[model samples]
Target: MSTADNNSQYDKFPEVAIAGRYHEAWQGWPQVVAALQEALAAQPRQKTVLVVECYHGVAQQELLKALILPLRPAALFDAADARRSTAEIEALIAGDLTDDPVFGRRSSLPLAAFFDPAKCAQMQQAIAAVSHGLVVVAGTGAALMADGDLLVYADLARWEIQQRFRRGELGNYGADNARADLLSRYKRAFFIDWRVLDRHKVPLLQRADFLLDTHQAGSPRLVSGAALHAGLRQVARQPFRVVPFFDPGVWGGQWMKHQFDLDPAAANYAWCFDCVPEENSLLMRFGDVRVEIPALDLVLLYPQPLLGDAAYARFGAEFPIRFDLLDTVGGQNLSLQVHPTLPYIRQQFGMAYTQDESYYLLAAEPDAGVCLGVKTGTRPDEMMAALAQAAQGEGRFDDARFINRFPARRHDHFLIPAGTVHCAGAGSVVLEISATPYLFTFKLWDWGRLGLDGRPRPLHLHHGGNVIDWQRDTDWVTRELVNRVEPVAAGPGWQEERTGLHPSQFIETRRHWFSVPVLHHTDGRVNVLNLIEGEEAVVESPSGSFAPFVVHFAETFIIPAAVGAYRIRPCGRSLGQRLGTLKAWVREEETPC
Candidate 1:
């Protein structure tokens, strides 16, 4: 479990050491504690016990201890002791927990259900008993209150929680196959947490008297009430930008390393989760205090505003689009894989939707290409047999003979609908835009490479075989999956080109090339955009001006549907060169599923 420390950016920021580790945390916890003290002072009760509620694995309980120990609360209710049995949680790993069709219904149930009923009653009794002395209630779901009580929400980024999971800080529920074993499980749990915790958020925010952002866990940001309201309103209406996070992988590339000025000490940067809200964070700065919350909070808080009526109708409260970078520039091909179809994923994995992805080639070397579908005449059974043989180390795979290969260059869009076999070959930087359903990829081959842990990577031959759409052979892939691009329209110094849709796709894509500022309307669907071929650009909207949000080369950004009309203009050196942007949105007709 000794993986590389992913967040080397901490070296450039002020850091504090806690729990035998150093982290890039703002030195703001004291301010938040002071605010809590002030808020408690106004309670006019001698027994002022603050209830700290947070997402699971957020180290806020430690923070609460540090903040409250000096006051010597008469009773400290540590709610962790009330957690449900691990066996019970593991038993329900594959059961749907929420009624929401698309999200909040996968893997383990929500943490709210993780508490033992008896322990919960005990905790409630403890809250009731505290009247003349100080009492402190702290943990996930600890702020479920009685009459006249103080509540505080300790927010943490889902990405940070996932990182902690990777470090084995969270308990293992038998997902020890690889480093990414719990990735999907964590995502599923997070969606449920959003449902379980978010309904109480508005009330908690308005009445809590204190709000804490503990993204770093060691240090928390305290926002004043006025500033919190302003920040929340801004987030509700403006274009949303999650704090981008990077991780190194077995097939990672160096393109992002050189482009984003990231820490180069690492071997390479693999995935830049630029705007996948479920696994990314949004830093909300209020005055000198800041708080980091899951980007999913926006969609949960303002479903119609952020995703619009059309998107909300289609995907419920979920943000349906995801944009991330898959860099193979100095590495190897991504695993030969096929995502499950919607039905297949639901039946086999308990997920509502499958990963329907598209690789928009942002840059590639001359020999770089994509391996897509199967060769012209390869049978589905034959491919499955070969995959089984390879998985068992029986023989070498003639990938060229078995998989169709096509040369890819800048701006090439390859549609990867579910069940299509594909992999982005080396020497390319691919901006993957697709449905938000990630972590269902059924890897068939890994070019005989071992993972970072020195173990052979896991392959889902049995599962993959069940889902491969064998008919998507070479001819169909070349003629259809490889996008059929055509100019759609043009305006002053700008033009729109439609990246043709594959018949199986639910998302529509297009690229905009402009030398001067150009206005684009969201038109009621969230837009996932990337500056595929530009140095930088400005994104301004009627809702608010995010001047110099300054998207650099290959950086992904999002425009929430709440920002109805927005303009993008070339910045820096791109003023002289035509700035190219690739964007994807849910198709209008496909929005009512």
Candidate 2:
């Protein structure tokens, strides 16, 4: 949380303009340029073109003005010239029927048009014409990675982009749309860039002579070759914590406010995006200064090393899982919704994966419940009628009549596979663990409520109706979605239980309780663990492969598959209570190693 200066080696991270306030992004680029200069000297003399690829909204031109021009390269080629005009890009996307405002447009279409080979080749020829002097190609693309060229990548997290966009640094599409529409477009752009970066991340890191972490405010560092490899391995093999960001919602609750010691002045804390890499920051400590970057870098830099061989084989470079909190305590129910099925997601959003989530009840109050599936005998037409009524603001969509409400208690695990409509009811705090595709939730109803911004939240009734499996009625859901708890084994002061719900799922989840250090090994699969009922625990490897990692109650930490044998020992508080932890990993059957 304290991102400025950990050691004081560098000046304080500068706060950039953000939503009527200031937010920190990567430190100045001066140091980065200096380090890069040294690295560049070792590169072959024939490497005349220096391509600096960057993510969107990174102000690549500004970076050049501040750092690169001082070096005085002979010719500078701005890649922005090659990009299709905004009108052209929008026109191409408009042709696709799947480009839904609520579900989001496809990223591939516009990207394909943006990276046309003819445009890239034309830009490359212009750079080549600039004879013996240094030619700098600054912006996105790898159209010119010759044998002697130097490629540097500039990366910023999606969260930073959001902050800048809100402050108007990133172009607001136009003044024609309202704030909500602009914000929606901004979010849509984030997903597009995410897919683009994820696709080329590994190759860029492999090819680039240097990597610039531009996520933090004032401390920028260049990493390459062995240093880059070793540093990434260190992060992947150790217990890593990303900076968690909180947001308020219309149905926000106070549970996270008290538990996490968050801002009390705010209305309430609804979501704590603790470990979702796409929207979170990874803080790396370098001596007295701290450098921050998007957590997605880990998955991009070393997919097999971080996600394990099996997971990589199945999910490719995508981080197949996610962990976040949804608090309803002293608030109201989440919108009744269903995530798109795998095929539907791929066809509609051009995404390779879909969201299949499960709610692990962290805390529950009296009469707390979860809205799951539809009532036993509800017809498809009946379900649509109710949603239509709510969308018209005629009345609150009644969950009791159409949706199955199950009483929720602490530690209750409710599986919500794609196609199963679900929501967390009032008076409960839920830890949502699911597949990493998080933005595709199709809300059929929102209880006639408005958003925190005072606008009616966009509803995806059309998409939700198409995705919901009507056969997943009350009886089928009650029998299948409710997880079964079966004791697996017990040792001195320790016990393990298999708590998974579906056999077809990719992740195998289990609960562990221990009074002493529990010995465990990754065995070629990454593990995500949560301290369900413990004050704290120290995760250590006897071989000193990684620094000892500490996790507090309600905190989720990752254990990379590369971390072989390790032990988790209960620390300071709650010595009387058995420390409880829930761990999930790729199933052994799927993991050949």
Candidate 3:
């Protein structure tokens, strides 16, 4: 099928071409085995060694069960055997993986820190001893053994890793504690495991002979490493969408379930991580086979082309902006929350920036509203005491007493710079546009409800109090944060408005209402956009630099800085109809390098 055929907003699995065409890829075990066997056969009489270096959450045991007898290697060396003892790893990462519920210090440990030198040397010596047949040296750090006859990278997506963590099926690398708390596992992975793995993955992705998609347990996909790189480079030159993952939460609602055609069996769809590259994956279609790789690979391997000149120089390998859906329609209010200030986030969590964000209302019921900032005359001590008592179940937090609840309308944009307390109330579907420091939220109240895990959700009253900006009261918020829209430019059939993010935040948002094709330029920075009001629209390169991309309503697409210029207009069912798109980009002067 053509790439445009799957551009529907309800498409859960979106696939794109690699280098303008679907290259060859092997699907299932037999096809993968045939390809590897042919490669091994070309080596003639020499002892062939196969090295399978995996990401931390990959199932090594499953790979062994699938490849052990088929390859029939004379000897096998599992690289995990060389990992440091559990106690050693704990002591090593204790400082980085703190007890904080939603935060951790970023770790600087290298991949070499997780392995024992003597054990690795022993594994290398063992590889040398195998004189005949295939010698398989497998596991996450297997590449340290020796240059192999065939290097296969068994990669796992970060979202899949999180699911495995929630299911108690995985643990931090070199630490055999699979049954740790879900938040603890995520903390360690964020602070330590993923950091070291990415450092190791870059070199391997550059040199691996084959790339394997082991996302599913038994169904594995394989492709050449060069083809993988070519595909990533191709993606950097065009507009595309990452594979979005949805999850149920205590405050989830039915909006996404109906709008995105999500699984109806799920309790409620609270979040659709539509454009979070760090936790989402990309699918490259090669004929009938689809190979999945972490979206961050594109960021790491080709940050300049994918993220643009100024953005790459400023954020390095990070995708600075994120777009997600927060559904509170037909559900309870979201937890009253506050994000850390820049200095607080840097000193407390080792992050470079705070999660300064804005909410653009997608759909709102008759009574839809948002709780933002404190009242003009509210006292800090008075509000804190009420929140403390409410958090302890003494009474429900009195929103009317201290907070300003603004009536929300469709397309209304609310600026929420870091340190300003805010949350979307029930009866609204919010398109949350923000910086990428996603997990830094410090919740002060949770509406006296237990989490999906049947336990009370965590509260960070002390942290929230420390970071809350007392000056963002109702008077200031109404004057500055609420619906700060201004007409910027217009054409024969289109108009553009600057729908802010606050001046203190680095992200700048613009909304376009177009009935005819509207031109947009990347101007040396990446642009993230969504069709907020339309059935479908097509994004075309003015110079025919890449193929025309189609996006449906509520679907977010990224325009790489490399694209230079593109145009968008209503298409398919929405042709000639008025459409609206919300676009965000990093402000040139304000973005911290």
Candidate 4:
């Protein structure tokens, strides 16, 4: 079917694009290629262009022929070769030459200059003149073309390289000069770095108006970043800053040192008086949104107690809630605990609390498992009795009535609602998204472990009992053990419900696997795109003009709200068929007998 006809099927959900880099030899490339082909086939012919930037080798030439030749003869133009003599490019721009005498009858699309700022400006002028056509720019060509008029940027390098180039580090080849030109050129940008973007400094590159990230695609990063950026952009004309959080060394991996110069010890968890004294918190404040919990260190980074008075004056009026990236390193099973809802927090703690949260499993050891809720048929009285016995040291009640206990595998996601008794298993790392600013926890049990300080970790038994929903309810948690099991029919870029387990909070969660041109949301909520397991994809939105970004394994990205629409195009091989056995297991359990 035609692209428009296919896209009509997924009209309900917002559109998003995935873009990144890849090597053909990687096992994931097959899947990436398949997905890209599908997206292209389903996308409107006029609206889609498979833009690829080659660093070296004959791969670019082969890939171009492989992708474009079979579909239709594409209008090809080389930015590098086009600049062989500045005179030729000028002649084309001046409309004196109807056809490229050098390349013969094949249509020579407008060639943009890379590295030369003046030529880059001329190319921008030429593109603005063309109402519609397929144009491909590669290498430095992509960056120069990124002068800000394109709607999407698919960056292939790590965030640091992009940052360096934006910071005038790439030989100062007038990097700052190019940036000044880009400031007004694009509206939104997306990166492959899944960690939270730093709000403290100026953004390295603002080429993207809307960014679609492939890192940790399952979390709330995109939506959160969008909201913060939009708010900050509105209040201040300064550019949003991008900060790196993950250190490869921590994961036993090696990354170039210059990518991000992060000194965990140097991070100050104090308030700065220069901004707003009362509302000061170490958490980096962008605009209305403040990220208090450091994703890497798991510490409160902003709004110190000393600044509480000012914080109250600035934030107390709106009572903004907080968001955290709760990290657990060792395996001591988290104390079985519960968080009081908003009413309870306000009544008991004398402060408002927003407790909604979703968990995205980062990494886990083979033995890690979590204890969630109670088993079916376990009566409330039995649970209460177990609680009492455990409190009195009369029984091993913690393990007996637990309803569901399962190993924590990599990438597993779980939603914990208020009043649900839950505990993170040992040897697992997770990204926790929640409503902010309350530290209320009621612990039901701890493995009798001691803290690093040679003391038993403190327990909040009295309060824990208050929030425990004694009634075992498994209705809210739905588990999808596998990814992309049912082959969704190919169509225009769209989102489909990959699993029945959906989040019930103000935010709704959906897993979509698409190979089509898609548009993103304009609503205020952030869109977090995690590259759970894929080759490469691109997210094009209305912010900056089209630029390239990379998405590798285990990385995450945040797409901001200012981006009006988005599109996704696969870049590498395809991810293989679903994990068959895992799919069966989940289906059997979710299916009502």
Candidate maximizing lDDT? 3
Off by over 4 Å in 4: 1-330, 350-353, 362-368, 379-397, 407-411, 427-429, 474-495, 498-504, 515-517, 535-538, 542-552, 568-593
Q: Which ranges in model 2 have alpha carbons more than 4 Å from their true place?
A: 1-29, 40-48, 94-97, 104-106, 109-122, 142-148, 171-180, 217-219, 350-352, 574-576, 588-593
| 542 Cα displacement, candidate 2 (Å) | 4.2
Off by over 4 Å in 1: 1-27, 92-110, 145-148, 172-208, 224-226, 542-549, 590-593
lDDT of 3 at 400: 85
Q: What's the true lDDT of residue 181 in model 4? A: 25
Error of 3 at 332 (Å): 1.1
lDDT of 1 at 310: 84
Cα error, residue 578 of model 2, in Å, equals: 1.4
Q: Model 1 over residues 178-253: C-alpha lDDT tens digits?
A: 3555544465545454445555555566665455676665666655444555555567566546778888889999
Q: Which of the predicted structures, 2 or 4, would earn the higher TM-score when compared with the native?
A: 2
Candidate 3 residue lDDT tens string, 259-297: 776666778999999899999999998767889999988
After superposing all C-alphas onto the true structure, candidate 3 shows an RMSD in angstroms of 2.6
Model 2 C-alpha lDDT per residue in residues 456-540, reported as the tens digit of each score = 8889888889999888898998888886788999999999998874665667788899988898888989888888887778889
Candidate 4, residues 343-448, lDDT tens digits: the string is 6666664444446555556557788666676666667666766766766667566565465676677766666667777777656655454444333556666665
In the order shown, the candidates' Cα RMSDs to the true structure are 6.1, 6.0, 2.6, 23.2
